[model samples]
Target: MKMKNIKLIGIGLVGAILMIGCTDLDEELNDSVNEAAGFSASDLLAGAYSSMRELQHEQDILASYVHSSDELIAPTRGADWDDAGAWRDHHLHSWTNTHPHIDKTWRDLNSRAFNAQLVLCNGDASATEIAEATFLRTLSDFFTLDLFGVVPRRACNEDLLQPPTQQLGRAEAIDVFISEMEAVLNDMPTANGPITATQNAGRMLLAKLYLNKAVYKATGQDGVAQPGPYTFDPVDMTMAINHLNEITGYSLEDDYFSSFTPTNTETSTEIIFVSENELGGATGNIRNRWHMTMHYNQQPSGWNGFVATADLYNLFEDGDVRRSTDIPGLTDAFGYNAGFLVGQQQGPSDKTLTSLIDLEDRPGNPLVFTEEVDIFSSNERNGIRVIKYLPNLELSADADGISFSNDDAPGNDYVFFRYADARLMKAEAILRGGTDTNGESALAIINELRTSRNASMLPAVTESDILDERSRELYWEGWRRNDQIRFNTFLGTWQAKADASPERALLMPIPAEALATNPNLTQNSGY
Candidate 1:
């Protein structure tokens, strides 16, 4: 099959496809878009955001490696996990030369990027719409780099039409992403012509670029998880720090939970970038899996699948308030019925249940104990249900309509980059190779996140701690595998998971199609 660069279609065209009345082009001059000329720019943007949701779903499956050990998946029907679960297959055992999501994700990201490029390259996209679109594209490339290390950097739709060459290696792709990001951020049009809109102030594209510089700049050829030829550049660190510090008019919400509810999107200060979800709009159910695990009984609970890992739960400190955010036993927020409860099955069983407090009851329930049951493996319930992205209010959580109610799903803007993440990256940089010329060390920066959460026992600010904090704060948001590789942990063993297999699982064995298309594209080290 020929690789179709579908994203090359311009905004006017793509918009026309998704929305019925959004086209600005005249039918005579552009008869191709005449059918879709009625589509709105916002609707076109919504279609682009759908791709974002797809990418997040793929990443979330991989992030489960944190607690997917024997302690977690054994009991839950995740038994077929090897064939059924994402962890046992794609991540844990490294089933190279077969997994298809890797390619699908790239294809989705490419499509999203192409759509954004279309908007920028064609039609009269308003400044706000263009800014949002570019932010989305930058995000797509940023994640693409994170996953593949080095990917083909194509900004123009025209670039995709050309016959492909060898897929670029990790280092080359890093440079490309950096250059593209620099261009994207600089070209980020204001929310308005002269005056920036307050609603658009918190976009996270720039901050994420700065946060991942060290990983991006560090080059490596081998895929089995050893330090590569890439050298860490302090100048890159400085530039990253500068970009991070430059984002203005955003602050952390004192109540961490405030940053996630549908209503919070409008007033939350922590949101750096949000994919606006209008009430009753499309693509609103992206977070159903997480919410269903905790709210299935409260009216439909919307339960289908997905849960949290014990490793992440263990990351919470004694007095840390964040734990209550989704712990085993807490109560409703205000008067609502939300919080942890105990007495739930960890996995499926042939035996009959004497109590209602089985797995069924456990859904939408919280923990009363400190321990998480390993349901998938032991047939015992051993993990906490995730509640992070579920909108706090019932209407916001309702499955009846699209995820974001016409951008009305409260204003819990998705935090692509925020001060906490920035500070953590700075800390990691220091631990890796940063200096204290400004009187700050990796330890100091790490403590900021710890202290803010009122964490009493802090780990020594080292490379390990930095990586650990990243897992704790940025888990499902996507960054686990990259951190594992850069810190040299991918090949090592951890929890119920390990890299003891025979082949290299390093750089997702160059996507199957790419290998068939380009001879220069060799498989990553271990595959």
Candidate 2:
């Protein structure tokens, strides 16, 4: 689990986000962060980047993105995973503005934006620092726009005592993001690995922005925004393709799970941008990818919180690499696989771990993961678990010399962007009415990816095929919601979530705390 030191800084925020009173004179933290910064350019830049580390964890931001979609669910398993119905509301699309997860995500993302902007606002920042900071700020804004349909902004030296007055609506935010990112693209250096900000990473963001422009451009009520049955402009699609074409120096990994392993930075060719994690650094809990779903009696005992839906499991055939398969590192002596986990699980010394907790349906029996799951109430055996990011078992109890445990941090760099997703976006652009720059047909690109994944080739491709392919390739990567939203299938009923989501669900409600602090924020209507 080695990485370039530049990519893995101590996860600590170089210094505290200076606190101030929100009085007639003092500028408080509630309105802005890094308001009274006197830190070095390096310290501020590193701090800016460090704020993103928390994104890799589930139960909040990533959970909201995934559990709201059809691919994942956090069913109430008897006494565990019932967080006051927070997980269930996400799956059922009944979340209010005050939803803890939604509120936390908004604050976390805003902090990221503020820290990056402080670097830009600082007089000492070099050109390279500015470019990287610009990318970080835009990335934070893009997420805010996508999730909440608005982004609050304080100018370069806005008064800290006053709340943020500028609120960029979705469409306007899109315009500013494109302009800012494009302006700095050439200033950033090419990255040695996916960890550092680079021109290619900037291009990837541009590609995403262009592809989703039409959706953001949709004008309607702030809260009850219309879910897309919208148009994909050929111009925007072509722009998306052009930006994708500019992204270089990455390729699809032949071994699909290698892209997410603990040593992925050394082994994988697919990663384009990642939140670089360190064994004893970075704030993100990457181990939760496995720990969130696995049973208490499994090899590395877990909280048994969430699972992949049966509908998503049914999408794949037996031979696909993306489908659950016995992984070399993860499938240790006890035998666990990389993707969707089902059937009886094994623990230490090849023991079949039994359900220690008295689950309603299967008490004192083998810890078997059945396909059936209900959000309101379920047993430990009700849902098929997933393990996308596998831990480095060399540090496990079995290994000699090196020491590790479930409590120790895992050095799995959480994926933010990968070449496979970019390639898929290119195919999506072509399907949406753009001609491929390299004369690559949509079917050819689709089939080519399938061949790499060991899945059967399709005779042709359609929008549905593209969406399904996205599901298979990018499952459990915190992108299912964005992909589902882009494909216009997000609101549709599926699996444990029986009812179709409302149009108002398209935009998560602006948190009440934000409204109280900033006069610019308008709550999305349904809340």
Candidate 3:
């Protein structure tokens, strides 16, 4: 990676002078102090990074992508998590422009893009700084494009007071994202460590963009109410494979749980890009993955929110290590095993944990999570909870006890991109008729991953097999929505979701607020 030498100009000084001239004595004094101590580009970069963290973990954003997918659902459990049916709307594919999560996510991504642009305009930014800022902007833009089917555009030099009217459509957004990523590829650092912005991270993003380009380019489904076949261009798959090959520094972690431990930032060899988080400080909300899923009586008590569908839980073969339900007798530094939590759960002291919230029928029995859920209104302990990201046991208040603070964020860095995803993407590309360069067949890649995860290797792989493999490997990691979309399974009927048209529900409706603010914004066809 090449670093550009750049010098900070007097923009800070000019701004300070303007503030002092326009404000009272206290404001002038504050400006005077700031002018003496020069503005830091590093601070700007940190802000850009924080924006990415917020975008990834915001409640609405997470719900839009994760809850809408088949792998996870925030079902209405007794008196909890109904949120006036907002959470249920996601899985049912009934989300509207007024959906709070949808609106907040759109606003957050747009704000992040603007903030990154401001950082890029800071004359002190080195080539490395510029590349990182560009990456952040592009990432937010990519999300905006992916979720809304349009990318809102605003130049740093443009007037902030004047609302942004310029927008890029799906195909145009894809092109811009790809081009911007390519421009920063050489300047971005390679992933030798846990840095957030890297060349390989950029490559992963590019591969994803290329892999989904065909879906972005699809047409003629406007106003349609059912999901139909969409053509996948071989060129897009080839591009996806080419970009995947460029990311060579990362390898799969032998233990599938290693990539998701509370200390994953320091321990996992698989994480390529992550939202760096800390115990006492703010960065990532990795805790939500646990806090949202676990029962209220569980050690390190959780909100008793989202849970895995029984159908998804049943997909895992018996004895598959990935499906291991072992609850460690004692909570280690790493916490419990990765995967779904069913049957009787134990506390930190290895005692059978009972639910504080009782069910309608089984009120006094131990809180045994069952695979079967009522869908409309489940008992407090009805659904199987997911603990895919190991709970943060190190932060527990006592060795024999587990303590969790609702306000405190987890220490684990949430992985945004990892080696396993790249491997799977490469395999999918090959299966879709992409040319293989490294002499590794699609079956070889799939079997390698499967075997490493303690599952039997398949003799052959099919498209359905690949989709199932993806669900097994990547469930609850926030890729399910995209995977389901690509597999044409987004609109398929599941536990609570009825069969719907992909054209109607695949893309989220543009938030009504966004449309009101920006006249240029147009709602998706069904909305």
Candidate 4:
């Protein structure tokens, strides 16, 4: 076993921590060995891209832990178990100690970035791909910084052996990442199409970079400090507008379910940044299928995890189509009717009471009561299961299997970015600036999203309404925690979630193992 050092490049056993954060700090981190091989710049860039994509595997597992509710399931039995709704505790502990996933992604991204620096810094690539690589580097850092908070910003491979230099905390925040990202955007090539076989062509990366600018400032008290070089700046609002305006030609499907259908072509419009999933790939989207949804057929016993919370379910307005799109009232997949009800106690044949859900009811949004309503396990995810990226008909045949490679899953790119996100960002920026910020215009941008849901359009939007809209629109896409934190509402309690969840929960704890490995490092508050 190699020495487990937080600052040193994570390799093999010490890698899983970065996977929790998807920092790419850990992946492809075997620089000691890789460097001696002396690969070409193109080879390095492609390898890095491959490593960056590994997060899909790690993210699928972590996301599973997020949806399990206290009310629905009995406590899980193991320390590394998902029963307590805190499987992340294991991720935090394992971060820098063992598990190569984290180290693999980090090393992969860093290797790519280092390769880009070597080529660009030395004038190797023609400057266009260099711009793309630079954008990737900043993006890789953004993922690391957002999750880990303080990460090494090494510009070259030579820095690998050096002690992990500490980067400033979110408290000393500058829009450095955003600024760096924007500077590269102007120089990089634009997306020729939604799907890219040869080039990176997604709008989500850019949208996400700007989308969080406001939150980044709001978090680090440094933005609001007086007489300091750092101050909250509204310039990001324009960045939000410009980047969003540049992305167009995508629209919502007539039915949200269309996007989730097996062998879906609609995903071309819905997904912006899908990681490539190879056929029979064990560590890919199936993890998502297994972790998030109940596969009574696959498990034999019953669905074991990821029930949505009552509070999260109620966030949807009545008649909003996304409630069904984001989460299903029951368990099971397309053809397994028995195990698909909302509150069934046993398997479909053993079913007793019909599964009923209260979150779907509203003064304005009453249930339409179609046969589509599922009533399976009593724990049929009292909330919705994520429906954003199910397999298309081509791959739908194998959907029930326990493991599938990238090629066997739906071809729809995992939508990391899209127009809907941009529009929401605009709505958020407008609401943040004040009542007159966009005047009637803000409502136009936000309400367009609601129009599809068949919900009432907001003649005017307040910050509260925008927050509600984001919860409705972007629920499982991974922005919930960020939105809650940005608005300073992370610590607040909802009906289902208790007050014990605090603002500190907004930022994750530094993996305990990470601190142990690098004794020089300190844990984040409330760890």
Candidate 5:
């Protein structure tokens, strides 16, 4: 067979297998091509991009990280989200090697890395195509290192059936990842109002890796797999700041909610890299952020599984616009609060919502979401629900013009890197004993963000204050686990959690399935 024919066959095989696995079989089946015999290099590159989307949505990876951090929690509401206690295990930091989500995320990310490698191996690809594939592979590798403390390694020519893929530890992996990103930085295109691999995206990724390099290299508290007592190398910190400063032509959105609306891809100026999701298109799972948290009685009902803790809610000052509660009676196009939902709930019709009697531990009153959660006997509506990403509300004219009440899939592009994050990280690096070009202090940087959000300027800043700012700014967008770990706060007691087993709980254990499939893998300490 010709090389193109072989590559096409490989693409078709992978697509068919993935189609069978994705829950929305109808959509995936429709997307799966009958054969890849006539596919071009761009078609293969598009396949790689689609695989990257899978990494974003698969196995609840985003939710797992949010729940594990201080900002959010997945409480078992009677019987709604027990999930074999998997949800609670994250908040409690007690997940085992066999944790289903952990294993699924591992497989999903590695599969993307491998698929990207396959695209590169097909010698017919152009230089641009090669750069794009390398970008995708590096993205997967970055996540693998961030979450698992190890990066799975395989060459483009490696056989799929190989039993053991080599692994690189955190320090080695960071060095290699940085070098790879640097090589492709200039080749990546700048965004032209559409999502694509870009120079800004590359710089943002490199900045993040450099900022966390100290945590990646830290070693202390024997048998504890947590981040520092970090040694923030001045060179790495300078590089992080310099890379962030180089990115231009983006700024913070005036309205905090604008960045997360259904039309965020076009509205948000802060986004540098995003997972492009379209409701009826070939990609986009960003709607899960909304579907997973809102109450069932609300318009576009949600799973009602995840809730923000009082600690996170309390971080917002009384006048802070980020707190959805402060914006009373204001609703988005979706008729839901723009941020956190608390107290009495309202639907699109402006009618008060009441929980069904059959709901576990029903309160028999208006559905009131409290900041406090009992963890044991909390009512079905005890915790404050999040609506950070507005629910999909577009109604088809042919269908009585009623909005989608429960869209399991939404189209808002999920932002992975944004300018605000880069700004915040710059602030953090300065605070952690690094200097800036203009002699800006960490407090000044933080105040700039606060002032933009209409929040009160703080008199002074501390490490704890910076962490709180991070939660307030970046909550539900991911980065909580990493922030917590980097600050040595992951194992601390918070809300309903106790600081038990702080050391070993920092890094997740290598999934049992991964170890079984690859003999070269070893479990993290204190599994």
Candidate 6:
């Protein structure tokens, strides 16, 4: 395959069977995404990559992670977002096994695993294809274990007719994934850049697994587990540092949001893994970030759902580029700055920037986002909105539609892993007892990124400082729940979910549908 520099290349695929849950009613688990007899491995591989857009949009899987964490919320604005009381359940950690998002997320994640393995199953997969497939499968399996406990496992050439009996538990699954990812890391392409599975991306993925190995070890495969002060062994920490060390030739972006803009694939130095979005179409869902938060009256009007909690917004100090910035053409043209959006929002250069109306609570007012928000009820403009994945204002707006809809833009590649995160992970690994691979103290290493973002130097560093720093730099990128769990602060009360959070809440329960479909899957503790 020709090296794809930055385009999120789309492989025309005969998409596969969704693999409803971890189990299959018939023989083929994650049944043939392509029902036809003959299919190319490349097509299956593209399906695997394309499906990863689910991770980009803050919905379903990412929604569960964000709504559960302290960083973001999906508060019911009167009657607007109160669907199934889903967001409320996630915020309160009062979700049941049958929660809709939980079931859907589980299915979506396993589907990725099944699709990747599908590529491997196809006899024609090249070495590069096999390497990428292996990485995707492990990535899917990794999240499955992290969010749930056990992941479905099947041997190569295993009977498609029999009910399979191998489901690896947390520790066992983690070990298997680590071994498998390491097994293929070196074979991954080095020249594909961050848009595909490259050696550097493999390294970053392995580092993540290793950093959380202690937690995986604590959360056994049979599934009952809680949040922890889990012993981050020096060996695991060292392995994380070592893998991160292998990821070379990348650095933090001078402008923090540069890592997230439309040209990120070509411009950002920090990206380690990203999805290729359309240059002209909205097939890519990166546009969801902006539309999900900004109010209807704001330029490129949004759904006015998903808002950031103040706790996360308060973490940044003055002059931190990560906090907010104005994208030259986009921000000036559309009236909203690109980071933590608070106070009054603005409209595009139309006859007049739109105004608030029909919102009974505050009609005829500007589209102002209030710092305060309510979960059960709030005016339309409540809580600060975020715009990490900036809109592509260059796309021609619909003459009749609200500035731009899905068709207007989606060129921004969805960022997965990045260099800044790797640096932070190494610093955290050292703080947890590993030797400093960067030859700098954890404080100095963190300060390097801090100074790059124009944030003031920290006088010192602590575990709390690390957690806050991660929040400031990586907010709304969909890793908060993982960070909070690792730091043992997941259960801490924040703006939304008050009262003591149950430790079992650290790991969501296996979807009831999954438990019913696959007996091998066991529920986590306290569910």
My TM-score estimates for the predictions, one after another, are 0.71, 0.91, 0.86, 0.69, 0.87, 0.91
Per-residue CA lDDT of model 5 for 1-527, tens digit only, reads: 00111233345344323311323334433343334424666777776776666655625557457878888877777777888987778888888999988877777777677667656777788777777778888887777777878777765544434543567787678888889888878877765453676788888888998999888777443323444667788889888888888888888777877777667878888888776666655545666687677777665656777788888898898767788633333363334467777777654442322221222223456777889886545667889888787756655445543446335556677778888898899898887766688677889889999998889999999988898899999987888988988887887888878665457676777787667656677778877
Q: For residues 312-367, what per-residue lDDT tens digits would candidate 6 score against the true structure? A: 99998877888888877666666767788887666554533343222212366666
Per-residue lDDT of candidate 4, residues 380-436 (tens digit): 223333334454322223455333334344344344454566678776765554232
Q: Of models 2 and 4, which has the larger TM-score?
A: 2
Q: What stretches of model 2 exceed 4 Å from their correct place?
A: 1-36, 221-224, 350-362, 395-407
The residue-level lDDT of candidate 4 at 322 comes to 67
- Report per-prediction Cα RMSD to one decimal: 8.4, 4.1, 6.2, 9.1, 5.8, 3.7
Residue 6 of model 4: what lDDT? 19
lDDT at position 360, candidate 1? 41
The digit string of per-residue lDDT tens for model 3 on 1-527 reads: 11222222332332222211222344544554344236567766666566566655636456877788887777787777878888888888888889988877776777667656666777888887788888888877777777777776765555433445567887667788888888888888765465568888888888998888777776444322224355667888888898899887667787777787657867787888876666566646667777788777665677888889877898888777778745453233223445877876654434223222322223666777888776578877788888777765543454354454423666677778899999999999888877767777899999999987878899999988998998898888878888888888888788767666456687788877667656666678878
Error of 2 at 26 (Å): 4.5
For candidate 6, list the clashing residue pairs, or say none. 8-276, 16-33, 17-33, 169-221, 170-221
lDDT of 6: 0.77
Provide the lDDT at 286 for model 4: 39
Task: For candidate 1, write residues 1-527 as lDDT tens digits.
Answer: 11111222354333222221122334432544433234456555554654444444433333323322221222233332333554455435555555665655555555556555555554667766676566666666666556655444333332222323435455565565556555545446444311121223322345455445555555444423334323556665666555555656656566665555555456566555544443444333345434435433322233423345466667767666555544221122211222222243232122121112323434344423224443345322344555555453433355343232333222233444455666676676565564535657677667777676667646566677887787766655545665665666655554445445442554455566655544444566656
Report model 4's TM-score to 2 decimal places.
0.69
lDDT of 2 at 395: 43
Which portions of model 5 miss their true places by more than 4 Å? Answer: 1-39, 219-226, 325-336, 348-363, 398-406
Q: Give the runs in model 4 whose Cα sits over 4 Å from its true position.
A: 1-37, 58-85, 88-123, 166-168, 171-174, 195-207, 218-232, 257-267, 279-283, 298-303, 325-386, 392-412, 434-440, 516-520
Stretches off by above 4 angstroms in model 3 are 1-39, 56-58, 220-228, 325-336, 348-362, 395-407
